[model samples]
Target: MAKSPMDTLQLSYIQIAIAFLLFAQAKSTTEHTSTPQPNDTNTACIASERSALLAFRAGLSDPANLLSSWKGDDCCGWKGVYCSNRTGHVVKLDLQGSGYTIDSDSRKVLAGNISSSLLGLQHLRYLDLSFNEFDKMQIPEFIGSLHKLRYLDLSMSMFIGRIPPQLGNLSNLQYLDLRSSYQDRDIHDGTYSTDIMWLSRLTSLEHLDMTYVDLSAIVHWLPVVNMLPTLKFLFLTSCQLRTSPESLQLSNLTSLETLFLVGNQFHQRSTPNWFWDLTSLKYLDISYNGFYGPFPDEIGNMTSMVELHLSANSLVGMMPSNMKNLCNLEVLYSYTSNINGSITELLHR
Candidate 1:
């Protein structure tokens, strides 16, 4: 009985999407049991991509039969599909919901009609329909025409309208989750999207989640996500964004490492100093924000931070005793903050 913190951040986003479907089924079982050649053959899965995955299983609503191993002539041996053993084709299609039952008022979801026959796989590259139950459809802009997508998860899967700006043409995306909090939704429940400037052409983006997206009138959204020079894990939690950025020049973002701006608008947009130039931050979530004064000291210069969340902020005085230089600090979340320091010299440094 202890999973809050948004259910531990949605079970760490489904354990990083089941560890990316166990690394794409261990790279398709090490390319068919590695090191086995003798004119090796076994390339099946492409009868028009197994009839477009049996017309995407006659448009879902599977109520837990779990696609019954998707019956047929080798969809690369079905079951959450994954092909590509030297071009068998259909590359990864993890039907997330982890063996079913992701309660959206659980009638054991897997709801209907998301056809377009998945644009016929076309050498698909990892697509997770997160926690199935597409009742609030409309996210299917032909899935941005697939284009060799590199990991795309339709989070929570209740998908409603307006997200697809043709997904910025995929640009070989690197992990992009369109998060949704549902019911406690944003963009007035029509699900949001305000021209993410096509997410600055992806630029090989590395892990970006639009948490409860709304993007509050994206004014070039922090210079178009600082032109994503291979960004590393960034989640815009409850994005009604206003994370103060009249330029602190976050150039090339120093290969950022996990930064989630939780519940946005840092206390009327004040907590900005360009996040201490992101010294390779290691998991820093600005929790349920609206942060007000005093807790700043450039966050002890980030010293390779390890899990720090200023929970339910409105932060107050005394915490920056140079945070004992963080020194790889672990898990510090101040709930309903009014931070008053002296944690026994910060727990003996």
Candidate 2:
């Protein structure tokens, strides 16, 4: 049909309107397709958390240049830092000091207050600040707030004062080591913990080492440790823990496998009756104490015992006759003690 001018104009306007709509729709579709995925956007370290880590580094004196990798914006890739794959949240920070003897130059050690900014890293699960020198500062109480922490090691660090009971707040903690080396004990002024009631809350704790920390005042140590059903390795060397364990307390430590009680104040050659009560012990060390009397017959019950050390004490009499049952025994140290009878048969066995 031959159209009028008005009809032609109307038809042209309709076509133009459709073309414009199509162009707009194509542009929108292109833009939508190019949009970044949520996971890609989350690949970068969270800005606030990165800042928090940088702030934490700022307070440290890094003479060794150990934290040089901490310059960039992406903290997940920083040295000694670990981030979650799903959320990119900082999960672990290990700033262990360079392996240096105490007598050597100590400049590599980190010293200063731990910045509160670390609290922003709410997902931190493992923190190890061992072998550093914090100038005898008390362990910060705020660290207890890191609820997700599973492993924490401050061993050989120069922290002094009562171990903050606040650490009990880490309910998920599985391994904790605050042990000081022989050098640390000599150079540092003092460190001790009088109360450990908070330990009762860490139901998941497995390995615990508090060697060289004075624990003489904690009368409930046995009872408190007994509550941890999952405990396996325990190191309490030179703790001066004088209290004896009660039968009730000994009954609960059924899972303990390795025990180190080296250099304590349990003054006698006679083995404490409770020593035999640890039926699951595979390793035992009670060296440099005042133990006396004959070798314990009750010790034969521990068929799983692998190492036995009873040196530098007053242990007397012949070795127990029933010790042949400890077929798993690998190492035995009975040097520097008083009179001891020979047992060639036990040795051959």
Best lDDT goes to which candidate?
Answer: 2
TM-score of 1: 0.33
| Runs of candidate 1 exceeding 4 Å displacement | 1-45, 60-86, 92-124, 128-133, 136-150, 156-178, 181-210, 213-231, 239-255, 264-278, 281-295, 299-349
312 in model 2: Cα distance from truth in Å? 1.1
Q: lDDT of each prediction vs. the true structure?
A: 0.72, 0.74
RMSD of every candidate to native, in Å, equals 18.1, 26.4
lDDT of 2 at 340: 55
lDDT of 2 by residue, 94-146 (tens): 78885447556654667787998989988888788888888768888999998
Among these predictions, the greatest TM-score belongs to 2
**Residue 234, candidate 2: C-alpha displacement in angstroms:** 0.4
**TM-score of each predicted structure versus truth:** 0.33, 0.83
Candidate 2 Cα RMSD after full superposition onto the native fold (Å): 26.4
